[model samples]
Every structure is written in structure tokens, then in C-alpha cells.
Target: MAQTTAKYHCLVTGFGPFYRYTEEENPAWLAVKPLTNSIIEDEQNNVRPIHVSTLQLPVSYQAVMDVVPLLHSHPPVFHPSIAEQAARNGVARPQKGYDFILHVGVAGRGALRVERVAHKFGYNMKDIYGRQAPVVETAPLPVEPEEPGDVPEEVLHISAPQIEQNQLELAEGPEPTPEPIRPKRGFGPGYENFQEEVYSDVNVVSLIRNMKQQNFEDVYLSMDAGHYLPDFIYYCSLAEVIRSVKPYERRRGTQVLVVHVPPVGQPLTSEQVTTALKLIITWVCSELQSIDDTLAKERFQ
Candidate 1:
């Protein structure tokens, strides 16, 4: 038997036309459109060959919600014209899971922004289709998980007579009614307990530093992704990752990141924006590999 080399996979997405930007003027999708089905590598970071798949997301909340889950489970690869030939040649196809998923959108500002968090609700704005996002109420703050060491040291011992009296009183009282379950509004049901805000565990500070080192001077770590389609998609993607993965590994939301890029020639050309995106994808792939390696080591220890 021969050893098989590990291959990394990533999905980078850009937005379609919206507002004043026409189909041809949308810089976000234009920058990434050429890199579809390309491969990126970073020898310095020990990253393997990352197969990149690109998607141009529509400027609609509903469309984004429909596609976000597929990205994590089974997304369509953006293959070139030679895809049929390659398939016939028996080349291996990419699998279901992605090492990282990056969503890119246009921002009014001239700088490149790596968003740190996305809000779960407050998306009151309309999409390109003149449709508003699902109006969801604010979610409650997340409760912290308790560890085994945090258990109480003392336990109350109930007397047999007290227990009998309590049981008799319960039997005498009317039966309690069960509360009806209300299905959440956004992205179907089962998300009633989602957090109000989801944070990406990706190191945005390091990402900004790396962008600056690569001559992208205007790069910044952004706290808010705004309440538009971009933020809506980010929340959808993050929430999907949290729902699919285990609670302990919920921070795997780090594997899903969103970037806000400025319009073309807003102090940066399309070429520069494309270069920055490539760099971002490379860095994220390396970071995810590092996390997996650390978890593997901890498991053995």
C-alpha cells in the first residue's frame, strides 16, 4: 500500500451586481472570477496544494441562504472549459468538506477589510430583488458551558417523608402543560437557539499584518460587516457551520471568513484586489492546517 498525500480545499465567493454597480461594474466578483479552479500554495507556511473553487453569490439573502449550506457540504466546482476532458482523463475530484470558505463583498471604503463578527439579526434592508430578509428578533446572549470540575461539592439529602409529601402534592396539582416550540424565521427551523452575534475565530489581526506586509497598506481588521446582504450572508454561513459541527468544535466558524473589498481603482486596482484575495486564501489554508495539527497532537497527549 502507498501513502496518499493530503490535499486542501477552499471556496471563495464574490457578490453579483447591486445598487449602483451593474453587472459589469461589480468589482468583487470580477476580482475572483479569474481564479476559479486554480491552485494556491505557500511553502513557507507548510500549506499543501489548496484547490480553489469560486462562486458569484447573488445580492439576495434568500439565494445566499440556499447556497451557504451547500458550500460546507457539497458545492459546485468552478471548472474551466476543459473540465469534461479532465473528467474523462480520470483526475480526482474535490470532496465535500472545505478547509476554508471566504466570502468577498464590495465596501464603500477604500481599504480591504477582514470582518471579525457578523450579527444574527437587524438586517432590515432590502435585497436586489426588493425582498427584505427574514425579520428575526434578537437572540439571547449565549450561556457558557460548564465543565465537570465546576460541579458543586455538596448534595442535599432528601428525607423519605419529605419526598412522599412532595410526591402527593405533585399528584394533587394539575398536570403541567408543555410549551409549544416556535420555529425560527430565518433559514428554516432549528436555529431558535443561535447566538445573537457570531464571531470568527480566524486571527484577523494577523491577516491585516500579512496584507500590510504584502504591500496592501490600507488593510484593516473590521469589527462590523454592516447590515446589508454581505453581513446577512456572513451570518448565514457562520450559523450553518455552527449547526453542522459539534458544539465543542463550533469555533470551526473560523474556517469560514468574509472579506470586504473596495471598488476597482478606489485606490486599488482589480489586479491588486485579486492578489490580496489569493494571499488571503493562502493564509487561511495554512492557519486551518495548523489548527488541525494542534488538535491531533493534543488527542495523542
Candidate 2:
């Protein structure tokens, strides 16, 4: 008989949307009820596909920090719901820091398709107010295609000559155009006002900074914010967030990756489980590899 070793579980966190006041909405926190019992079924089996910890926090950073201490540090929060998830499960606080912290939430502004922006800005990590200094702002302009016959994009830039002329006209117009669209000043979708939303973080900025500082060759951030960021920009008065650290000099550098989330409405029926096992196994295995690399280095080595 083979001896079974306990697997290291993750702590996942989410928050309710308080700032978003509307009819018939429970905020992102409502998703936790379903997320808790419904295991993160990895149909692809990329490694360890299951999310061991799943919990939610309010949109408020302080409320989130009431549970997880690390998240309380500063503006861009780390996985704010991890502590709640760990407690939700019977597992005592681990003897060490979490093997991984997975935070899941609704990406509100994701409706618009901005693969190029997501890809261009890389992780798109921003500050608490959603504005970063040194970044020039201008009205949205037509994106130049990367290649001929290619699609256009909306990467941030402030070099528009027309925006200069156009904003002048608009500013001189009716009361609405006094302030041109700008960071924290609102220039993107749904932001017609002189102000915009707050900027939160999944820690891509610090994580990238750390990787760069360490000169880690193969570290890449996995992301899932999708196109929702823009929508959030409108109601939240938030700015697009991205890491500020430059990767340390190295032969090779860190590359952040965005993972695709499985579609909603997963059924826990036996039929699905049987077919989905392969994917589950693969995801678990990949996660296992990540773990083995750090905690189980000897085994992997």
C-alpha cells in the first residue's frame, strides 16, 4: 500500500461590491456561496486544478484586511480573502506562509474586448486611486494594428495631436468638456466626468518588482482580469493598475501569464466528474509541480 501525503491547499478570497449600488445585486461576494462547495474543477488537468481555499471579502480594503493581515499593508492588496478561506476549511493556519494565494472575484468591466490592452500593459497593475505618475493621458484614439490586416488596440498613450486640438474645442464648449479625459480624471468608457474610479491590485506590480529584483528567469504572472477592468474604471473612479518594478538584469526575464477561467455553471454531476478528471489531474499536477519546485524541491530535483 502507498502512503498518502497531505496536499498543500490554497486560500482564495473574493469581495462584495459595495461601491456598486444597484438593484438586485449582492456584489461579487455573492459568488462565494457557490464557489465554496463547488470545487475548482480543472477539466484540463494542467496540474492541480482544484482551488483548495475559496472565500470572499467586501470591496472595501479595510474590511478585507480585518481577516488577512498582509492585505492590510497598502493600496494594492494581496489575496485579501485567503485567511477567511483557510478558516472556513478545517485546516489550522499553516506552519508556514500559504503555498499559494488565489483570489477570485468578478471582473466588472470585462464586457469590452481589450486583449491588446491587457496584453500590452502586461498585468495592468495600478495604484489605489488608479493613477500612476509619469503616464501621459489623452482621449481614446484608434489603435494602430500590430501587423497589416491585424486588429486595432487601446494601449495607454498621450501623444495624440488630434486629442490636443479636439480637447481644446471640447473644453471651450459647454460646461461638460472643461476637463479632458485623464487618469483619475476619467477618459475611458463610461467616464465622461472629470473623475474616475479607485485602483485595486492582485499584486502583479509588487510581484513583478520582486521577480525583477531577484532576476528570476522564468517567473511569469498568471492573470484573469479580462476586459472587465474598463467597466470597473467607469463606476469606481479607479485607474488601470500595473506593476512599477523593472525586472533585474538577467539573461532571461520574468513573464506574467493570464490563466483562463473555466466557464460558469459547472455541474457537480457524476457524469461531468468522470469526464473532467483528466483536466483536474493535469491542473493539480501543474500546481503540484509549482509546489514541488518550492517545498518539494528535492523531489523535483
Tens digits of per-residue lDDT for model 2 on 1-301?
2323344444444444434432124333333344443344343433433334445544442242244444222222335445445456433243433443333343322121111112112213332334232232455689765763353344244469867988899888877536663443213332243232223322444444443454432223433344233222212211221222235521111111122222122212222222222222233344454545565445456
Tell me the spans in candidate 2 whose CA falls farther than 4 Å from its real position. 1-4, 17-31, 34-51, 61-92, 107-286, 290-301
How many clashes would you count in candidate 2? 45
Q: Where is model 1 more than 4 Å wrong at Cα?
A: 1-4, 74-96, 137-188, 248-254, 298-301
- TM agreement with the true structure for every prediction: 0.73, 0.36
Residue-level error in angstroms, candidate 2, position 297: 6.4
Looking at model 2, report the run of 10 residues with the lowest lDDT sum.
Answer: 111-120
The collision pairs in model 1 are none
lDDT of 1 by residue, 1-301 (tens): 2322477777677888888998768989888787788878777766778887776767988777666665556433324533463344333335546777789999985888889999876676778999887755556789999876676654245678888999999999999898986533343355667887888868888987887888778788888899788887888888877767876652344387888988889888888888989888887777877776777768779
